[model samples]
Target: MATQVTFSEVKNNGLGYWGVLGFFGLLVLGGVFAFLHMHEGHYTTGMNNQVVWGIPHVFAIFLIVAASGAANIATIGTVFGQDVYKPQGRLSLALAGSLLFGGLVVLLLDLGSLGHVIEMAKGALNFKSIFAWNMILYSGFLLIITLYNWTMMDRRKIAKKLYKPLGIVNMAWRFMLTMGTGSIFGFLVARQYYDAAILAPLFIVSSYVFGTAIYSLVLMASFKLTGRDLGDIVLNRLRNSMAVYLVLVLFFEMTRHLTNLYATEHHAVEAYILTGDSIFTSLFWYGQIILGSLVPMFLVWCRFFKNNRLAHVTAAVLAVIGGMIQIYVILIGGQSFPLILFPNAEVSSAFFDGVNNAYTATMSEYLLGIGGVGLAVALVIVGMKGLRLLPTSLADDVIDPLNLEKK
Candidate 1:
């Protein structure tokens, strides 16, 4: 048997490390702006009745989607019987749990009341509400994944037997959680841009793409920073997987928009996203397509730089940047367009009813969104420092002996 890879805690012994932590701390301080919004009211933010969800939702939803995707790494090892991925199991689990927590923090802060959340926790919730269902799903996901991660680390025979079942359950639950999240927008009946069934599956595939990208970057950075060896075999496997996911995500996007464009009723929203000179158009074309998809794809698939480490980093960074732009377009751009309340007649009202309502994000919204990202990074840092999350090395000879065996 291959020598079982050992897990060790990251060394927390540098000014550079402290500086990174301080940077995340500054981001968390941005939450003071969130507190101001909460105390003063939603009026303080760009969100109004029309654009009910703003930049915060963009960040929160992305983090949540990425969280679900991050868990895929562990699932490949435990559920798929892929021993090549087994060494990555612990770090994957830690990142998944931490990302979810960060997202939930942003989401909860955005809610109307802290007391309402307390009440909901006390079982004063509407089970019929998708929001409530998500709360359950999110909470249950954390609990089950924590247990699952524990089982993976436990060597007791009882824990071993329980491990596979828990892994299967974790996978199923995460799918449900992400599907529920997509349904938040997918089920918006009043919104012309949102009422599509494809959003759920699209979100699922998107989670895979964005989540894998984040994981690959974190893995590389962690290894490099800690002076550990991470091999080309693993990097190639991960980047290739990300490339496949990117293609799938692009397919889903084409299906979504093409299906929408086929209907005359959907033409206006498509025009807003694809043809207009607005920020949404630029973000979709440049950020999502060019920088996010095409460029990263080239970096990974290019034969000349297949094994180059810098190529891997560039692809991962661009993939993450593109993922953010995609979410922003979906959340804010979808809301930015006028609602077609009267199909046959032009309408106007004080609430900007049936007209394109501009959502100009304020400093507070930007800070809060940045804070959400900061929260995720902070959680990752803390997990690495506090737990035995990082492995000593992932050199090809150490982790990829299975390939030799197969040959």
Candidate 2:
């Protein structure tokens, strides 16, 4: 018989918990200050007409994409009937919701005015705009996730019956949400880097990679600090899953670049990103490819570190860092490449046409991005405290009883 898993709120009310709260609170304050500073004048920031979406977009997009991916755990457990993953459903949903909130907070604040958001909420939306579609998609995601969470937590027979159905809806909504996010760029036909249709699928896969990494890190940390039994079985499963997603992301990335290389029209932008003597090239090769994908792949799959918890943790951290760099390259690097106003003709203009746009992020941008992350993590911590999201234990025997019986 399988061991019945029980859930409980985190019992850690010590200085450690308070310290974490205090630290993230300060970060949130910093983000608010950054927003206020930028509100004084858009001229104070590093953004320009060419590069409007800066570091904050990178962080916001990552959080948003990861939010969709984070819910996959719950989807697998409930929709697919994965017994090992069922106990993790609540935490997964919580994290998904919290991450979305954090990402949206950054995105809204980055707009430079609360009034703009309010106006959008109160005013008419252009149906033709992808941004308008995204507004609907995001709001729908939150609603569906909330409903799914209720089904998971409720013990009534009706709620149990609704679980799988709600899971399916949530899963589909997440895919649409991620795809909508990708389409934001994919629909930008004017930009050299943003016109690819593959971006939709690429973003979907990326969400898997980044989301799983963040979830693993949070799971490990929460279990360790709260003195819960986090088993090798669960960790190993997550490690293997993340490794698979990493490979998919790499494949998609390669395909995207190779497709761009194959096209005559995209040649200039490809050269700029791949071979140019710029930070994008270094970040692509070193930060995204080497450190993010390859290193984590080796760490997670290597037999030497198969059972090493630290190695797994390190891999998760690297994956998150690599994910951020990947987004930066996509958003900033793509915007930095000069737009080809006239194909096959050299055009010069007073607005610095035909030349790469220069942008350097200010401290305010960095603070806002970091603050978004802090908010996401802090929400997770608080959720664990107030709700019975986490299982009492995730021991190998508890999570995988068949293996224990076999042993």
Candidate 3:
């Protein structure tokens, strides 16, 4: 008979844990300071009339989309009946909720005032706006995930019965949340870069890539720190899954760019992003394509690095960096591109019309974005500390009963 897998709270109250806590605490503080500073005046930051959504939005959107993606592990285990993934479902759900909260924090702060956020929360919503719809989606995601976690953690018989059903609901909700986020940009018909239906699916696939990368890294780090038995079977599965997501995201991205290039009206923006002498061009080709997608793919598939833990870690880290750069290119680059206010007509405006908008991220903006990440990590750590979110062992024999039979 296979040994039963047990779950436990993280008990490492050592120097390393405290040090990490302190570091993330500082990051959260920095984000608070940035919000206060920016709240003083929008002029304090790099945002202008042309480029409204700045670096914070990039981070916010990335985390929000990634939150949906991170839940994929739990979805696979419960919805698909994958036993190998079941062990990590608790951690997956916890991480998903934490990431969403962190991302929402940054988003609310960046909206410019506490009062505005309060009013929105108090039911002052414009139903016509996609943003309003997303507010509901985000709230529903948190509530559903919370309840799902309860079902997973509770010992009640009813909870066990509801687990798969809740997982299915959470999976559907996550898809809608991510699609809504992508639609925020896709619905912008005036923007040459974002006016594509492909964005919804593109973001969905991109979430898979980014979320899986982040989850792999966090899982590895947690198991390593806690001295848990994290077997190669789990790591290999995550690595292979990430590789597939990378290919899908790349395909979607290629389709998006190709569709843009095919349209004569979008040629200028395409040239600017793809071939122009700008940071976006470098980030797209070097950061997103080569280092982010291709290199990670090579690392995972190369026989030389097979079963190599360090290689997997490097690939996950690179994927994360590449994912962030990809979001930057999409969110910031899209806004920086000149708007087509007057097609085929000589138009001049004092508000820097007919030219690419200039934007340089301030230190405050970087802090706020980094803070959101720190908050997410911190929340996961705290959740693990208070709850039995991690399996005591994820050894091949433990997760896969077939391994025991073979042995």
Candidate 4:
């Protein structure tokens, strides 16, 4: 059966008008920033030999992880057959796909040579290298999402029958691609993050949490900006899932640290992250643990979290902010903490040094990083407005328009 509509187009038209304007305004600002930097080269940013990966890496990783995560929201309805999630599926796909556009923008800027990236894409790829595999997988993922979206738009009359197989195919591909992303960070045998076999799973799990959190915030913003209600069924469904997701993330987070605590080689790094007399300690304790983890959890824990829309929205916004901080800690902190000891790999210089000499991001690094974020945000806004994600639905309680006209 076809689900025709509820949300009034007149109201949506108004929102769409202003939303599009705001969206493009941001895109223009980001484009200006990007254009100026493109000519300057990556050297315009903070990245250097000491701290090679900076903010761009942080946001790009977050975007990709968020992109993979978006599937969880869509799949629960399509693949797993949970109807409550149905309302949000299309929006989820749009958000995930859109976020990817933002990620690519930052990554392109981060690469010292856009010219080389083009050659690499056209040239041969070694499947053994995670970078090569990621290039292929990301392209494939983008293609699948584009196709999935096109088919959905055309098949609105009977959305399920036409899209079922596509949904399954998309899921399988995303799982592999997400694994590819994790492998990029996970296989770093030279670093503290690599030794634990659990990093891959961690990325996969956290991707969903981050995806939903980001989507939730955008959903609220879109709804408020447009004056629409996403329907109680959709919101309620998402609320419980959000809570469970947070719980799962916290659990894995605890487990990851516990594992490190047990491993002798990784122990020093974990100590530096957890309680070391270093900057990482502030990031972990203040940013990740407190602002990112605890405060949000406490908000979600309140009985009013589900009942009050603002509380729910707040939880999501905080979670997204915290997740970003966590990403920095994982990527920057892990790299900066130094492996301290090399068991399997031989090293010529292992003499008088501590974590003090470990690498850190520089000023150009911060500028480049901020630029990536601007690009991602601009992408999300443009994609949402250009694409028809924000459907004109008043609420789940409203009678179907098709049924109403029949009467």
Candidate 5:
């Protein structure tokens, strides 16, 4: 830490005692919720047949995307030998490992049954279903990251040696993860998803943006809370990266929308989401556009503003805040409107018939998601405390942080 910190330096290492307290408190919320759901069944989760994959899906997807993106920061150094990016690399790596684990916890909990939790390992060999492979792929993804990032008392030096290989491998692994996730939506030939070929590329691109954004913001907060100076150079470069990502993410989203509009039947699900009723519009306009897009863009791209640190931090925060909403719109919003086009006329599945099928998340579902994040937070905080996640040899505002990977 840049500043002198003490044991009583505030709860959870300046994340605010309240933040940590609440975070832990949620475990209680989740536990109580889980108990209720397990006893009563999944009738409380806000899920319907049309919206089967709700917020938990969005949350789970967010972790995976963010997890992969976190590792990309490591590439800037290990693969490219650009150490100016190194200051943020450790945090990126740590969070990547933590988020992947957290996401798995959330996803498995959503399944509502732990029948195949271990069988998830056997899934990759199947190759019959892309989703099946994800069971194994993400597991390996987390493993490689953990092994590469974790500090082994005896193997610490040896582990660092793997950085270079891990860099390139990390890139490839992320490619697989994104492709696997996209395939979940893309390869639905039985439905309109057959035309979702473009979705995979967009998913990868979005991961880059959202992942970097979240890590950047979290690091900024870490610095400020820990009393470290980010220096102008580091902040400037990060802001530049955020600005670039924000613009690129916008391009990807816009392009996807246009493509969906131009093609026949492809527009069926997405169209309703982009230009639909209150639910979708509110999330897109208020959540995506406002929280995710325009605000961050203006802040990061402002020429007159020399406050790179603030710009960097704000942009990163907005990127995650907006990206979170964006992912929700894509994942949950994508599911909100089911696939139903009878031969006679256009149709939407806002509700189910015959009986009120219970699609809600129930208590257990939310608890699992909460617990996953809690696990991540606890792990991250402990990692930070143990390893001093802050730059140890780094000086604040140095002209260059020294490219560890390059030289």
Candidate 6:
């Protein structure tokens, strides 16, 4: 039988829908806290002169990275002609746009000079600034994704003809976006934690793991909530893919750190990551490595989780948490370690130039960061209700195999 891939809106309007919406609604209030901080000054938050980026950056950067990764579903379908992933193509584009917007919201809100954002935008662009190039990349992403969506959703032969080429364009665009975002840190030579060229590809790999984990969770949850059958066939494919991404993340992280450790100057930063204070050590070893990497890999490959829905959901949640922790370790941990201004001798200055800086994130920062995630979730929820994003059914037999040689 030919696959009947009819797109449909979620018809359910039960307590679950409203409850989730309400949860995200509360998260939006974090914007108010952010605004207050912006008005009062950044001093009220955990961010000091030393630790400039803080947790808000950690959240914003992760969502933005995952946003690029989320496009991989559509890339797999249109670019490679994978029929199984085609059903997910529309929602992937929608999530990509929404998640990027949400992360942008948190990032803009956290800026000390929120009003100056417009002034800066109006000014001439500096080609040398990675930040300036990112502004262009992000704006272009929204436009391209919108056009891609129109092609996928509109039932016109001309639009259908446009989908494949546009999909290829989007695939390439997302790669550039990931590369630019990673280069934001990688290009920073003064910072010992971020000078490695490997960071660009590492960001790409991380996006793969984070994006897939989030898409899996959202897919499974949306289907189950609306009483749809997401087949083992599809779930297993995603589960396996996520496991491989997790492995790739581990490999890249090890390679990056090992390469850094070889340089004498990088030792201080490495020590901070490996044997720092209780919080840093716990987040790196326990959160990033243990919860983020090893545990999820175990769950993905475990005999008990094979074909088990509960196991897949649990693993997905763990992966998301792990992704966040990894970002936290990289962003916060990088700044927490004292910059080596005077390599020859012990140094002290008003900026705490040669000593490990103490940073304790305030409730406001936490609200703003967590709210960014909530904002992304809210966007997905609203988008589903407003558009035909989900497939009517994803049963094993209902989807057409791309080729006759079936797995």
| lDDT by residue (tens digit), candidate 4, 61-100 | 8888888887677777678876555555667777777677
Instruction: Name the runs in model 1 displaced over 4 angstroms.
Output: 1-3, 402-407
lDDT of 1 at 224: 85
Measured on C-alpha atoms, candidate 6 has an lDDT of 0.85
Clashes per model (N, Cα, C within 3 A): 0, 0, 0, 7, 13, 0
- Tell me the whole-model lDDT of each prediction, alpha carbons only: 0.86, 0.90, 0.90, 0.68, 0.65, 0.85
Q: Write the per-residue lDDT of candidate 6 for residues 1-407, one digit (tens) a residue.
A: 22477878877798898898888878878766665765688878888888899888888999999999888888988899877888899888888887898888888888877788887678868889999889889999999999999999998999989999999999999999999999998998888899878889999989988888989988998898888877777888888888999999999999999998999989878887888674778998898889888888899899877888888888888988999989888888888777777786898877677877778888888888778888888888998988999998887767744534253
Q: What is the lDDT for 194 in model 2? A: 83
Query: Across residues 1-407, which tens digit of lDDT does each residue of candidate 3 receive?
Result: 12278999999999978887888889999998998888888898998888998999989999999999999999998999887888788899899998999999999888856676778778899998989999999999999999999998898999999999999999999989999999998999999899798999999998988889999999999999999988888899899899999999999999999989998999989999999998999999999999999999999999999989899999999999999999999998999888887888656688888888889999999899989999999999989999999999888778776673231
RMSD of each: 1.8, 1.4, 1.6, 4.5, 5.0, 1.8
Candidate 2 vs candidate 4, TM-score winner: 2
Model 1 scores a C-alpha lDDT of 0.86
User: In candidate 1, what are the lDDT values of residues 1-407, reduced to their tens digit?
Assistant: 22457788888688867787888889988875665665588888888888889888888899899999999998998999887677887888888887888888888788777666677668799877888899989999999888888887777998889889999999999899999999998988878789998999999999988889999988998898788998887788789899889999899999999999999999988998999878999999999989999899999999988789899999999999999999999998999888888887788887788777788877787778778888888888888888788888888877866656331
Report the alpha-carbon TM-score of model 6 versus the true structure. 0.96
Q: Is candidate 1 or candidate 5 better by lDDT?
A: 1
How do all models score by TM-score? 0.95, 0.97, 0.97, 0.85, 0.82, 0.96
Residue 146 alpha-carbon offset, candidate 1, angstroms: 0.5
Q: Give the TM-score of candidate 2.
A: 0.97
Q: Which candidate, 2 or 5, would have the higher lDDT against the true structure?
A: 2
Candidate 6 stretches with Cα past 4 Å from truth are: 1-3, 400-407
Which residue ranges in model 4 land beyond 4 Å of their true spot?
A: 1-24, 31-35, 38-43, 156-160, 339-354, 357-380, 383-387, 398-407
lDDT of 2 by residue, 264-345 (tens): 9999888888888999999999999999999999999999998798999999999999999999999999999888888999
Worst 10 residues of 6 by lDDT: 398-407
Error of 1 at 72 (Å): 0.5
